[model samples]
Target: MQFDAILKQKDEIIQQLQSQINPLKNLVEQLLAEVKLLREQNAALLELIKEKDKRIQKLELVEHQYHQLTKLVYGRSSEKTSTALPGQLSLGIDAELVEACNINDGQKIESYTKIKSEKKKHPGRNEIPAHLERKYIDIHPENLPADARTLRYNRNRTIGI
Candidate 1:
């Protein structure tokens, strides 16, 4: 009878140990899966950061070019003036703006010639309507000198143009 009782107690202890160990084994597997998921998420985040860094570098280069062009055009350092032509507009002015009475005089001359030619072709059409005819006035700027005008242009974010 004594030997039977010892055998029964040993069986019970073995059964209890297996019950506890089964749950612990399942818990460890779940923890490993969670760790793998976190690692994948971290890799995705790193790729996104690299893309943003490239875009930022490109913008900084364009801005630096714009600053250099401005210095060439205005004959001054960047810190000197708050008023400046837009980045792309400076390119237009560099191509078009001449020394004669600032930049727009040549443009105005061309427009005037076109209007006069049109008026000569159509006599009755050339008559100014009452609503269209108005006194012309020029508003002077307070900050810039008499000859200076501000032209602004927004930079295109697209690469190469």
Candidate 2:
């Protein structure tokens, strides 16, 4: 009878322990799920941070390029030259004198005219020609002294509609 009672008490104790263990097991499972979710969120946040960093780097690069472009447009337009070495002759010319000279000189010169070529019909669709006026714009270099002369002047022609 004592053995039977001991067995019964031991069985009751085991049942109580199992009941406590069931709740603890469930709690452990819940904690594990929370930890997994937190890990995933951390990974996603890290990826987002990395992408933001890349975007920031790109924006910085673009800003740097914009500053360089601004400098090119509004800054000095002349090329920098080193100091002339000994025995080197200066090739700069007086541009003001060149500009003062008149090419026409109020004199009539003989003109030689060329014969006009015959117009050839194109094989494609007849496209009417839009006779647009020509526009001329003179661009001068910056930072040149009034007495200084440019080595060469460029002539550009653009047609306007």
Candidate 3:
């Protein structure tokens, strides 16, 4: 009877542990499912970001190409070219119209005279205006000797006069 009681007590303890372990196992399985779902969503989002980055790079490349093309088309011209051959003119008119107006190789064209200008010749001295007042001054020195004689004076005008 004593051995039976010991065996029964061990069986009851094992039953209680089994009952507790079943609910814990179910909780662990549920948590593992949630983790797997989160990982899948994260991977999908990463793939979407990679695709968007590749598209952005392609758009940037296209924009750069367009910019280069516009610069080539609309930018300032170099205007550099080989010199044209002598007597080989480009009249820009139609060939038929040019042929109709072409001059003969041996015929001489009429010449035109250009008007020319000539500098005016210097006129001789101008007469003084009759309205100007004339004043004369005697330049005789006060300290001259008693025998000093008078001489003809020069007739000159100052700018103020």
TM-score of each: 0.41, 0.43, 0.39
Model 2, backbone clash pairs (residues 3+ apart or across chains), number: 0
The stretch of ten residues in a row with the least summed lDDT in candidate 1 is 91-100
Which 10 consecutive residues of model 2 have the lowest summed lDDT?
152-161
TM-score of 1: 0.41
Q: Which stretches of candidate 3 lie over 4 Å from their true place?
A: 1-13, 78-161
Show pairs that collide, candidate 1. Answer: 86-153
The lDDT of model 1 is: 0.69
lDDT of 3 at 153: 63
Tens digit of per-residue lDDT, candidate 3, span 28-64: 9999999999999999999999889767866777897
* Candidate lDDT (C-alpha), each: 0.69, 0.76, 0.77
**Candidate 2 accuracy as TM-score:** 0.43
Compared with the true structure, what per-residue lDDT tens digits does model 1 show for residues 1-161?
99999999999999999999989999999999999999999999999998887678667778988986677777666544544556634434331133224544445434334444344554445557678756645454578986775544334433231
Give the best candidate by TM-score. 2
